[model samples]
Target: MRDLLPPGVHVAESFGDPPGAVLLPEEEPAVARAVDRRRREYTTVRHLARRALRCLGHGAAALPPGEDRAPRWPTGVVGALTHCDGYRAAAVADATVVASVGIDAEPHEALPEEALGGVALPEEREHLARLDAAHPEFRWDRLLFSAKESVYKAWYPVTGAWLGFEQAVLTFDPAGSFRARVLPEAVVPGGPVVFDGRWCVTRSFVTTAVVVTRPDAAPPAPCGCPAR
Candidate 1:
């Protein structure tokens, strides 16, 4: 999984844990209105984020939520976190060396058919159709959805602007990777940037990530399977 990320980004991960009774001092208030399961998932991922931060030479500190509800990392750090069912993970990077990152994980199962209408663009659907024709085994539609998610994650921090699924065009390859181009209409920093990302299918889940260090750096090559 680390190989798929760009330089400077570090990841931390953990399996499911039963809901605990206490929240770290900084995490308590944010979860005051959350239900038990949401609270448990939130704490577990933050815990993973802290561990990853430490690995990057950062001290453990409360990661608060920003107005848009994204994690507010300590000054000089940019990162993202994700969790699904039994898994949880976090990735962090120095702000100086890397601009932003976005990571996501989903069950290997196919995305529900009905939701595709909202998750895919007409061009993306055509792209998925081609992927489906060429490689019938994997769920290309779901993979496209995941790719868009990673694109959005990396994008929001850079611009703090909303990017609908239709606003970006995504294409995938046979090697478990993807590329995303933001439409010109979207007000991204320094204009639209192409994002190259890697994805892998493990025994339990499909994970994807996008790492951005410079607005003009060339996109990295796609990486292969079993991420995590």
Candidate 2:
């Protein structure tokens, strides 16, 4: 996962359940009513997030979710968190060097048939079909889903607008990278319309990440529309 990010970003990741992980007082409310599984995922990711923060020479801080349910990072920091069966990870960077960071992990398996229609554009599906035929070992459909997720994570913090599945066209390279071209309908003034990201498939998971540098980072003047 660390290899997926660019320099100046700090990342921490764990596989399987986090042993002895506990939530801080400020973070407990967010998961107050969550089941054990939810609590575990929440606790583990926050723990890793703080660890990444510490690596950046900052002290530990509670990461509560804002009204939008995105983590409220410390001032001067931009970051992202992700969790999936058997995996939990966090990445953070100084806002001065990195404008924003987004990362996601998913099981290395085919996406459910019904989901592909909603997640992939027609061209993206065609591209995936060709990749699948030539590189049958990779779960191209699932990797596409993960790539879009990483794009949104990077997009939302800057645009504060929803990027629908149909709003972006995606393409993949079998050599571990992908690109997302945000269509005009979803573009925001002063915000990036394209994102370049990387992907990795391990024995158990497929993970992707996007890092947008400063001068093109997020929290751009809100487009005045609520997140959908």
Candidate 3:
């Protein structure tokens, strides 16, 4: 793999696979002056993401309504969407082959350790603390946040079971990338699937990416986790 990226990956990866393209709302200064500042940025990300999906031979048929919401791409296809201050990105693949996919990006900064109590499970908090103890300079908070997000994106598609943040604990190696196992060792109905993911941070931005494959399409192998 090249820098954690694979060869012969989806052609979409060519446009910056984990694509983040922007069509700014800079032209709407008048509308910007009238509406909440948020509407402008939101409009821009949606516009750019839609156009990008269209170029992929999927078009608006591959999009969801809310920018923060997941897309309603073609059946048997999985989709992931992400947005940051000035950019937004999305990914699409066969859903059956890919169990569930989740992608998240956030600015590189220490999230308030004290404030996330409601969302972070006790084991999750401790795991993050251990990671911090091991790597003082690395921002472990981003890892925890991204893990929860990956869990959400992956969970919804498989179990169709909505889970609270504390419902699962994310175990990562060193990067924000990791695997998720739901608590109490409960069966996921269809699977206790392998959640494969990757992430990166540069300058002031941090992003985490994940794609959980359904075992039905790519049956659970003895070796485990062959990334797409």
Candidate 4:
């Protein structure tokens, strides 16, 4: 997941349940009625989020969900979180350097046939078919879904609007990257917005991330150092 992001963006990931995970006082209400599995995932991800925040020099703090269910990050910070069966991750950056960040992870398996129509644009489906034919080892459909998830995560923070599944057209490169062309209908003031992102496939999961740097920010350092 770290490879999917750029410099100055702190990312943390956990596989399976995290030991000693507990909900902060402010975070408890959000999952008060959730099942055990839901509670564990939520708690584990927030725990990683605070750890990432501390890496940015912030104190550990509660990350309750906003009205829209997105984690309400502390002031001066921008981030995104994702959780799947056995994997959980959080990525954060100082708002001064990064405009927004989005990430997602899914099991490396084919998306259900019934969900293909809802998740992929017609042209995207055609592209996936061609890719699958050439590289049967990868699940193109699942990767497409994960990419779109990352796009939406990156979009909402900037636009403050919902981006539907069909709102973006995506194309992938076999070389570990993707491009999402946000359709004009999605309503960004500047019309269409194109997001370039990277993807990775491991033995267990397929992950994708999109990071938008602030136009006025200085270049990041060579290492994965957090922004000053």
Candidate 5:
């Protein structure tokens, strides 16, 4: 179950049926480098991620190097990381016990509706258009930008295929966690891929999303998978 941390302050979500707890550190500056915005941003998010890790009984020094480009935790761990203006956070779950998990956060921003053209599929654009129409002031583009990012981080580890923002379509339930469907014929691993997600924006400037997928359901001993 997801616990609301603060009223009108933010939102958080978890995936894949983990029985463990999720920690959402209230946002605050962690580094004293007022001179370097980038450094301060890194420090803030690192602090949030560290707190999340600690909740799992792991210390900051115990975390391993992240994946080459995807949102990956050290070997033997499954997780995702993300940060937005004034906020940095992470979500982790034992892969052996919970598959893959992803989390994302982004500050509200105005985006050209046209900018979404190349990033979102035709149907996706149509769906979001309806959303934008309903809520004329909604920052749908930024929301998609964040949601797609969360999906990429979650899917990358399993498919081992980098999904372009344009390759997948995200359909949001607007007031609820959205849905993302990989375009048919899209490149995916040669097996079952479980894709399920949820999202919420408890405040006007921030949006948070989570996607948890289980290991692909495999066939009998030997259809065609190469034995590792």
Candidate 6:
């Protein structure tokens, strides 16, 4: 999983075929309100996240839920968490090295056919179809949706703005990565930043990740935590 992440980032993953235990005190309230399945996923991902932080040299710490329901990391860290059937993972990086990061995992299966229209732009749909025709084995629609999710996760923290699926046009490469061009109206102060992402199909799941570094900010320092 670490191989799929960008430099300065680390990832930890777990399988859920036989669901793991839910043991985080910080997550107890949230888990108590969720159904059995959601509770299992929520707990597993948080566990993975805390472990990743530990590997980054931080001791055990509770990852509280943020205003947007994203995991709030400790100072100096920016990270993302994702979970799906049989897969749960978390990726984290020192904020000085990476501005933000987002990751998502989904079952390697077709998305619900009805969801296609709402989740993809017309251009994106056409691109997916072409890629599908070319590569026949991959579930292009599902991968596109996963990529969009990763884009949103990575975008939100930087701008604190909402991005719909149509706000960016996503294009994929045969090499298992993608680039997203922000639509004109969706441009921020950056005027339009291209988001780079990587995806891999493994262990019966498709996982996608995106990382953004602070190219425009002051030189890297260990004190800034955008996700905090």
lDDT: worst 10-residue window of model 4: 219-228
Superior by lDDT: candidate 2 or candidate 3: 2
After TM-score superposition, the amount by which residue 172's alpha carbon in candidate 4 deviates from its true location, in angstroms, is 0.3
> What TM-score goes with each of the models?
0.88, 0.93, 0.70, 0.95, 0.70, 0.89
State the displacement of the C-alpha of residue 223, model 1, in Å, after optimal TM-score superposition: 18
Model 1 residue 53 CA deviation in Å: 0.5
Candidate 2's residue-wise lDDT over 1-228, tens digit each? 887886678888889666877788999999999999999999999988888888666647889899999989999999999999999998888887787898999999989999999999889999999999999999999999999999999999988999888899999999999999999888899999889999999957999999998864553331221100
Candidate 5 lDDT tens digits, 1-228: 123111111222322222232222322232233465554444444444454555444434233234473433545556666655555565554455445555677667765667776677778778878999998666787778877877777677667677788867777776666767776666665622335566666555445445453446332121121100
Instruction: Give model 3's clash tally.
Output: 5
Candidate 1, superposed: residue stretches over 4 Å from native: 18-22, 187-189, 215-228
lDDT, residue 68, model 2: 97
Indicate whether candidate 4 or candidate 5 has the larger lDDT.
4
What is candidate 2's TM-score against the reference?
A: 0.93
Residue pair clashes in candidate 1: none
Candidate 2, clashing residue pairs?
Answer: 158-218, 158-219
How many residue pairs clash in all the candidates, one count each?
0, 2, 5, 0, 1, 0
lDDT of each: 0.78, 0.88, 0.55, 0.88, 0.54, 0.79
Deviation from truth (RMSD, Å), model 4: 2.1
lDDT (10s digit) by residue, model 1, range 83-159: 88888888887787678898988877789888899999888889889889998878787778777888899998888
- lDDT tens digits, residue span 58-167, model 4: 64878999999999999899999999998999899889998899999999988999898899989999999999999888899999999999999998998888899899
Ranked by TM-score, the better of candidates 1 and 2 is 2
* Residue 183's lDDT in candidate 1: 83
